[model samples]
Target: MIHFTPKFYLIGRVTHTGTQRDGTPFSQVWKTIDSLGSGTYGDVVLQELQGSPGGGCLHAVKSITKKAHKNNKKILTNELKALIAVKKHPTKVVTFHGWYQDSQQTMFIAMEYVSGGSLERYMRKLKRVENILISSTSPLLVKICDFGIAKSADIDASGLKT
Candidate 1:
């Protein structure tokens, strides 16, 4: 049978790609560099794909749980769809690259790494004109990263998944 093992992000030892997580197959992964922040569910790790198509570019790894409310299929579908929609935008939001799962059903979101500063940091550096006034010329541009509990959009929207 084609065993579709579930995977979620975790906070522990992750073997390099090619090894199986709990039984699911993950080829290999390099060490994490930065912390991209965490949510109620899981955390994010920053790393680089060694010798990838473009010779080792950076990537963001979102480690979430398969045991979460929506399950893997739902989460994957939503993220894939969102990525398709936002890929063309020239913003600071991370670009969706791909996904992986482990035998125990842990999922990880792989996306393009952003070299620019984060939204929080950008906002902090902005100068407040007054207590009631907010600066309109602040460099911190915010982009909404929207994902719902359900698969909000259709898969294959960008035709990249096929």
Candidate 2:
């Protein structure tokens, strides 16, 4: 069995420079609060900046393990490319923070921690999400995309469902 407790560990966080989500400044150290999610390669953790400017200090930190698998490398390389591509024309996304790596063979991606229930849970009673696009284009058809399982440089993913 796995045991988890609130712990603070010093790790390299690849975070965006300057103010973060809602003008929250980035802290050099972060406290691991809990596990947000996980997958075959790694997991996402909810972390709090050691000394945030003020309230709203929570941020989602994605950690991926570096293995000898060529496929993993390819996926990571593609993800990085995709991220860089978006930086030029970032849109239709949440606040994007940068990424970093620790001494351990783990790469950490820091981004805006968007808190909310699942889409299906709050879709019918939609108040926030306004509209869904309908079109013949691939972009439009790909209403849902999973960047985690992204492998191709073309931005196509495996789990394209909510």
Candidate 3:
């Protein structure tokens, strides 16, 4: 596993070339930065990958992983599904790029990296009380992340697991 410290950003670019399981051409240049944060399932890292072939345009990459897929397979699947569901609403949610599993059975989810810190940390930095509430019309919008414990509301009324 690739380990990086918190808030680490590279100053230069590097090329990375590899092959998928099916033997397809996979070439990308990215600056792997420090981890964004971690959750019960795994950690999220910040990266910037080349957007086009032979182009300098770089896009933010959010790399999510799980140490043991067997123990958190269900949670991983649910998080992926939830991310895909909310991907269209980029302003209100993080965008899902793609996903793949490595030889170690570790699943990697590529997503949009939001540079802003978490809402909790931002509020604390401002020296605001924890109980303070902002109105709906406030310009600032905070998104709720970490969907590991999220459940689907489309479940059947009979309480049957889907």
Candidate 4:
């Protein structure tokens, strides 16, 4: 039987693009740069994707400690399903690379790291500017994402049910 894994994300992510000469997957090493935000459920961090500097790869890794809540796993599973549902529209939604569970059972969701600064920060800058407008050629679209209760019982790290 084929195995199906589940992926979870609330933003964009990076995936392994190639294998090594020995036919083994090249291991990825993620280094945390800073903390973006945190909440009752988990914390988001700015991570630098090492060994691929030229790719301009950076990811926001959201880590939810197993002790965060009693149903943390279930909530994350639902989030994963919602992420998968929007995978086709990556420009509007965050791309999900994948997730990992450490030995401590802390779930880490890998996503794209937006570097233009937070919306709030951008707004403040706009207020100070004499004239700020969206270019007709490139309109800015601010979206509020909402994913209702969703969960996938059969999902994991090895593979996801696309």
Candidate 5:
């Protein structure tokens, strides 16, 4: 396990810049201003990382507390594993930037910031505006996230169906 010592540059301002296990530069210059959503595991926040003409690059950061670590290690592991497994398919899934832990052992996952609201909310708005009901067959691009409950298939020694 990699442990990081928190660095506080200013009051209430914590910045972390270092290299990950894979030799990737992990930097957190953005501040999490508002929460996007929350679940049983943790809360997702909207972070402004890079500056651009159109409101810069926003990212969704998930904060997983240490308390959940003890009981949900497997779940956390599965989430990271699933993200890494599907990292190549950007169009089909959320882009997994990288994961890191703070000095307090709180894990954070940074991913591509999806501007549009969730599918459920989007459908609701569309129905209200267009006065048309949307069904599952409707052509819409959706990405499946929250891999904390994801499970990998088991394989036998023969490398065939068990």
Candidate 6:
């Protein structure tokens, strides 16, 4: 239950704004909606821009305490910088939409929310259903995603952020 206090910075956002459908950002948040997934740090949610009347879109809002981020700053910084340097590729990793922070011990990173969930989970579901065809999609997508990650890294290294 990630509750964004009203005091949190509110920003206006637009969707499918430019090339590659890069979301529009008139302000920090493009839109606001009910969150869909949960993790220890934060939750993913679909949000709509304020006063846009355009509704909301899928976004993963990672909420982390300042302590947690500071503890993992080295890795996090690498990941963030790498992510920022990379171009948008659906086959690789998820896209970094935007981020927000407050005086409180909380920081939020808004990223593209892949609706299909994780590849590992998708694989498990395929096994349970015993569907060979569906099973293939997971690997294929994961590979594409891997390429995306690799593209973000230096040629010789495993890239930043394990």
Identify the candidate with maximal TM-score.
5
Q: Judge candidate 2 at residue 15 and give its lDDT.
A: 30
List TM-score per model, in order.
Answer: 0.56, 0.56, 0.58, 0.61, 0.67, 0.52
lDDT of 6 by residue, 1-162 (tens): 111322434443323222223443332235555565554444456655544454345565555565754555544444455656553443565566655555675656666655554544545644322111121354554321112212234422443442
Enumerate clash totals for all models, in the order shown.
Answer: 17, 4, 0, 11, 0, 12
lDDT of 3: 0.51
Name the 10 consecutive residues with the lowest summed lDDT in model 5. Answer: 127-136
Which is the better candidate, 3 or 4, if ranked by TM-score?
4
**Candidate numbers sorted by TM-score from highest down:** 5, 4, 3, 1, 2, 6
The superposed Cα distance between candidate 5 and the true structure at residue 132, in angstroms, equals 21
Residue 53 in model 4: lDDT:
49
Worst 10 residues of 1 by lDDT: 128-137
Q: How do the residues 133-157 of candidate 5 rate in per-residue lDDT, one tens digit apiece? A: 1223346556656664354522334
Writing each residue's lDDT as its tens digit, candidate 3 over 1-162 gives: 122112222354444455545767566666655666665556666666566764443333433455544456666666566666665566666556666554445666666554555655546676322212222235665444445523442223343233
Comparison by TM-score, 3 against 5, better one: 5
The deviation in Å at residue 122 for candidate 5 is 3.5
Off by over 4 Å in 2: 1-27, 52-56, 68-72, 87-91, 120-145, 155-162
Model 4 score (lDDT): 0.54
Off by over 4 Å in 6: 1-25, 28-42, 70-72, 125-162
All candidates: CA RMSD (Å): 8.8, 10.6, 8.3, 9.4, 7.1, 8.3
Candidate 3 ranges beyond 4 A from true positions: 1-26, 50-72, 124-139, 149-162
Off by over 4 Å in 1: 1-29, 51-56, 70-72, 90-93, 124-162
Worst 10 residues of 6 by lDDT: 127-136
For residues 1-162, write the lDDT of model 4, one tens digit per residue.
011122332233333333544655454555666887765567888877667544447776677776775655677777676666567675665566676665467777776665544455556644322112221224664431223223344445643343
**Model 5 per-residue lDDT at 53:** 35
